[model samples]
Target: MPDDCRNIYKTCRKAAGLTQEAAAERLGISVESLRAYETGQRVPPNEVVELMVILYNAQHLAFQHLRETNALYSSVVPEVRPRSVLEASAKLTNRIFLFAESHADRRLLRITEDNVIDASERAEFNAIMEDLQEIVEAALELRCARESS
Candidate 1:
């Protein structure tokens, strides 16, 4: 996860003149935990990442990488697709879902405990993952089931 999207997290924190301690305090996390996130050793949950977007004034970063369905109301949702997808049937939505999957893999998520996130956000993240999973599955189906249809 080195130099990954979480770099945006570290850059934004520094640009805002907040040390890791300060930012972690605002996010209700330990400085060590925040360091883990910045270093790409641990991925923060969506709520923590969302809080960073607000704190860092870089909402676009969330839409670009976080795949935040909540960001639809946040005005940072990208107006244009930022990527080209191999699955034409899936397009940007499937690409976004795959990015989401890549960013928060279960192996990576094992480092970030479930208790760090609240019940509501945990539920929301689960729901979002479920929807993204559906999108990804559909894309796979189309890719394997049909060719130049």
Candidate 2:
């Protein structure tokens, strides 16, 4: 309910890999209505939210499948000088810790509905940071091993 449901809806739709027109059709809504939601001119009804959840779930599954396949292929034909998992994870953990600590001072001002959205954003950001950390560590480890040879 925070940060403009319309914008959130639109983002979720895109994240689910749905074109505006396709999402509109699936939701039994007009393209104009979908556009309005994306443009922050209108909020979707609860029914639309339910539909979006379904769409997002589907998209997440597809993404997981793709990721797994890529990982499998990479294992067989690894990249040169890639970071190791441990190094990347440690880096991301440190970054998130710093960010959370820095933002701690502003927590008092972040009250109300906007705060909820901000919190969600922070969580998503942290997740991404952790992922990047893992990637970088893997790459670093790979690079070190190559150099040692």
Candidate 3:
């Protein structure tokens, strides 16, 4: 996926080699509706987005859709960059290795050993959470890569 694209919906549709009419027809929506979505004049519903995901064979778009539409979801869901399956797998493995080297498991255990996150441990706890999120993002990317294949 090109990072410069203004809209994932538009980008994916183009990547799928779909004209607006064809994509709209396949998605069971009108061309105007799809144009509205692509132009960001309206948010596509989850179901329509799901259809696009299947039609485009682009799973990452689902997450990107949610993140783009919902503020809370956007805060929680990591932005998964599109990559080849091999790249995704390598990224996931690298994340796991980095997490292990950080000894986050031991740190987490200590932080929760007393069922409380002490002020001193807060920074480390947050850092560990970030590492965990990176792992999750990589996993999602791998899944997306497989679907795209």
Top candidate by TM-score: 3
TM-score of 3: 0.92
Shift of residue 89 alpha carbon in model 3, Å: 0.6
What's every prediction's RMSD, in angstroms? 16.8, 17.2, 2.5
Off by over 4 Å in 3: 1-6
lDDT by residue (tens digit), candidate 3, 1-149: 22443378998999999999999999999999999888777888999999999999888888888877778997988998899999999999999999999889898998989998889999999999999999999999999998898
Q: Of models 2 and 3, which has the larger lDDT?
A: 3
Clashes of each: 0, 13, 0
lDDT of 1 by residue, 1-149 (tens): 43545466787688678999989998888999899878777778788887886776554445544542344543532232222234535563655667577765553365446546565457656755665555654454344324212
Better of 1 and 2 by lDDT: 1
lDDT for residue 110 in candidate 2, whole number 0-100: 53
> Which residue window of length 10 is worst by lDDT in model 3?
1-10
Candidate 2 segments exceeding 4 Å error = 1-6, 58-149
TM-scores for all predictions: 0.43, 0.36, 0.92
Which candidate wins on lDDT? 3
Name the better of 1 and 2 by TM-score.
1
Residue pairs that clash (backbone atoms under 3 angstroms), model 1 = none
Of candidates 3 and 1, the better by TM-score? 3
Root mean square deviation (Cα) for candidate 2:
17.2
